[model samples]
Target chain A: MSEADQGAVVDLLGVLAYAELTAFDRLAEDARMAPTLTGRAALARMAAAEITHHVRLTERLVELGADPSAAMAPFTSALDTFHESTRPSTWLEGLVKAYVGDGLAADFYREIAEFLPDPDRALVLEVLDDTGHADFAVREVRAAIAADRRLAGRLALWGRRLVGEAITRSQAVIAEHDRLADLIVTGTGDLAGIGRLIERITDAHTERMKALGLRP
Target chain B: MSEADQGAVVDLLGVLAYAELTAFDRLAEDARMAPTLTGRAALARMAAAEITHHVRLTERLVELGADPSAAMAPFTSALDTFHESTRPSTWLEGLVKAYVGDGLAADFYREIAEFLPDPDRALVLEVLDDTGHADFAVREVRAAIAADRRLAGRLALWGRRLVGEAITRSQAVIAEHDRLADLIVTGTGDLAGIGRLIERITDAHTERMKALGLRP
Candidate 1:
C-alpha cells in the first residue's frame, strides 16, 4: 500500500475505534431504559463488547505510531450526526436500534474488512461480534413481536429508518474518504458484486423482520 | 441461610450488578472526554470489565430465583441521584471522578465481598479492575496538577466532595436496606469492625488523593 493509503486506513481505524467506544457508552445508558432486568443486562453486555473492539483498534493505531485522535477526528462529525439523528427514545426503540444498527454496521465492516491489508483485515474480522449476540437480539425482537403483534409494524418501520439513516451517513463517510471507497470498489472487484452483497444484507434484514412477524 | 436471608443476598447482588453495569456505561462515556486516544481506550477497556462483573452477579441472582430487576430496583433511585449529583463538567473532572469515585467503590466492594458467599465473593474479587487502571487515572490527575500547581487545592477539594457524596449516598443505601447492613455487620463480627473498615477505606482514599497530587 502507498503512504496515502496507509494513512487513510489508519484514519478509518481510528474512526471505527472511537465509534465503538462511544457506541458502548450510548448503549450502556440505553440499558437503563430497558423494561426488564434481563433486557437491561443483555444490552449492557452488548455495549461492553464495543470497548473490546475499541481497544484492539486503538492498539493497532498505536503500533502504527499514529495519533488516534487526529485520525478519528475527520469522521467524528459524520458519525455523531448519524447517532444523534437516530437516537432511540424508548426501550424497545433502543433494542431495535442495537439490533438493526449494529447488524448493518457489522455487515458494512465485513465488506470493508476485505479491502484492508493482511493483519488488519484479520483483526477487523475477528473484532466483529459473533452471531450468538446477533441471534440473541433477533430472538428478543421476535419474542416481543410474538407477545404483542401490534409492535411488529412499528418496530419494523423503525428498523427500516435506522438502515436508511445508516446508509446515508455511511455514504457521507465514503464520499469524504475517496481512497476508502476506491479500496472497497477495487477490493470487491466490481459494483455488481457490491450490489449483490447489499442485497444479501437486505435479504437477511427482511428475514429478520419476518421472523419478528413484520412485513418488509 | 433462611429464605429471607437468601432473598436479601439476591437483592444485594442485583444492586451491585446493576451498579457495575451502569458504572461501566458512565465511565465509557466519560472516557471520550479524555485528551488522548490511549487514555480513552484504557478507560473503555475498564468499562468492559464491569460487564463481566454484571454477568457474574446476574447469574447469582438467577440461581436464587430472584428477579434481577426487582432486586436492583430499590437502589436505582439512590444510585442515579449519586451519579447525577456528581456529574463531571470537564475532562479532568471526569478523570478525577473515575479515579476517586471508582477507587472508593472498589474499596467498599472489597470490604463488602467478605459478607458474600463463597463463589460470589470470589467472583467479586476477581472482577475488580486492577490497580494499573486506577494508577493511570492517578497519573493523569497528578500530571494535570504538576502542570498547574495552583489547581491542586481546587481538585483536592473536589476529591473530598466526591468522597463525601459517595459516603452520604452509601449510608442512605445501607439505611434503606437493613438486611444488607445486617449482612455487612454480622459478617464482619461487629459495628466496631465496620467502623474500622470505613476508616481503612477513608485512609486509602486519602492516599489515593495524595498520589494524585491532591491533599488528603
Candidate 2:
C-alpha cells in the first residue's frame, strides 16, 4: 500500500472507533429522554451493543500498532458537530436519529469498506453489521407517528434535518481530509466509482427514512 | 410462601431492576464528565455491566409472572431523588459517587439478600458482585486528592453528602414501602437482626470511604 493509502486506513479505523464510542455515549444519554422505563432500558441495551462494537474496532486498531485513543482523536470534532447540531428533543426524534442517522452512516461505511483489501474489508464489513437495531427504532417511530398523525410532519422535518446535518458534517470531513478521500477513489480504482458509492448511500438512506415513515 | 412474602419478593426485584437500569443511565451520563476519552470508556464499560445485571433481575421477575415495569415503578421516585440530589459536578465527584454510593448500595443489598430464601438469596448474591470496579474509582479519586490536597477536603465533603443523600432515600424507601421493608425484617426473623444488618452496612461504608481516603 502507498503511504497515503496507509494514512487513509488509519483515518478510517480511527473515525470508526470514535464513532462507536460516541454512539454508545449519546445513546445512553438519549435513553434518559425515553418516556417509559421499558423504553429507557431498550435504548440502554442498544447503547451497550455499541460498546461491544467499539471493543472490536479498538482491537483491530491495536493489532495495527496504532494507539486507539490517538487514532480516534482526529475525527472527534466532525462527529461531535454532527451530534450537537442534531440532538434529538423527543423520544421519537431520538429513535429516528438512531434508526435514520446511524443507518445512513452504516450505509456509507459499508460502501467504503468494500474498497478495503482482504481481512480489513471483512473486518469492516463485520463491524458495520447493525444487529437488527433499526427494526426496533422503526417500529417505535412508526407507531408514534401513527398514534399522533401530526407527529408525522414534525418528525418528517426532524428526519430531514438529521439527514441535512449528517450531510453537512460529512462534507466537511471530505473537504478537510483529502487523503482519506483520495484513498477511497484510489481504492475503487476510479472517480466514477466514488460517485456511484455516494449514490448508493443516498439510495439506502431514503429507504431508511421511508422505513421510519419519514420523507427523505 | 406467604402471600405477603411473595409480594415482598416482587417488590424487591422490581426496585432492584429499576435501580440497575437507572445506574446504567446515570453512569453513562456520568461518563460524559470523564476528563479523558480513556476514562470515559472505562465508565461506559461499567455502565454496560449494569445492563447485564439488570437483565438477570428482570428475567427472574418475569419468571415469577410479574410485570417487570409495574414492579419497578414504585422505587422510581426514590432512586431519581437520590440521583438528582447528588448529581456529581466533576469527574472526581462522579467517581466518588460511583464507588462510594454504589458500594454502600451493594453492601446493603447483600445484607438483605441473605434474608431471602434459597434462589432469591443466590440471585441477589450473583447480582451484587462488584468485580473490583471500586478499585478503579478509589485509585482515581485518591490520585486526584494526592495531586491537590485541597481537593481532599472538598471531596470528603462530597463523600459525606453522598452518604447523607443515600440514607435519606433509604429511609424514604423503608417508610413508603412496607412490603419490602417487612420482607427484610420477617425474613431476618427479628428486629435485632435488622439492626445488626444496618450496623454491618455502616461498617462496610466506612471501609469503602477509608479506601478512598475519606472519613466516614
> Which candidate tops DockQ?
2
Query: What TM-score goes with each of the models?
Result: 0.89, 0.94
The interface root-mean-square deviation of each model, in the order shown, is: 2.0, 0.7
lDDT of 1 by residue, A1-216 (tens): 788778767966877887887688678778878777677778878887887788788789888888777777788788889889998888777877887787778778877887788788888888885736666667877888888888888887888898899889988888888778787787778889889878877887777666556677
Residue A76 accuracy (lDDT) in model 1: 74
Residue pairs with clashing backbones, model 1 = none
Deviation (Å) of A109 in candidate 1: 1.6
Q: Candidate 1, residues B107-174: lDDT per residue as tens digits?
A: 89878877877776787777764636777787888888889998888887888889999999999999
Residue A38 lDDT in candidate 1: 76
* Collision count for each candidate, in order: 0, 0
Highest-scoring model, lDDT: 2
lDDT of 2 by residue, A79-127 (tens): 9988998888888888988888888888888778777775777888888
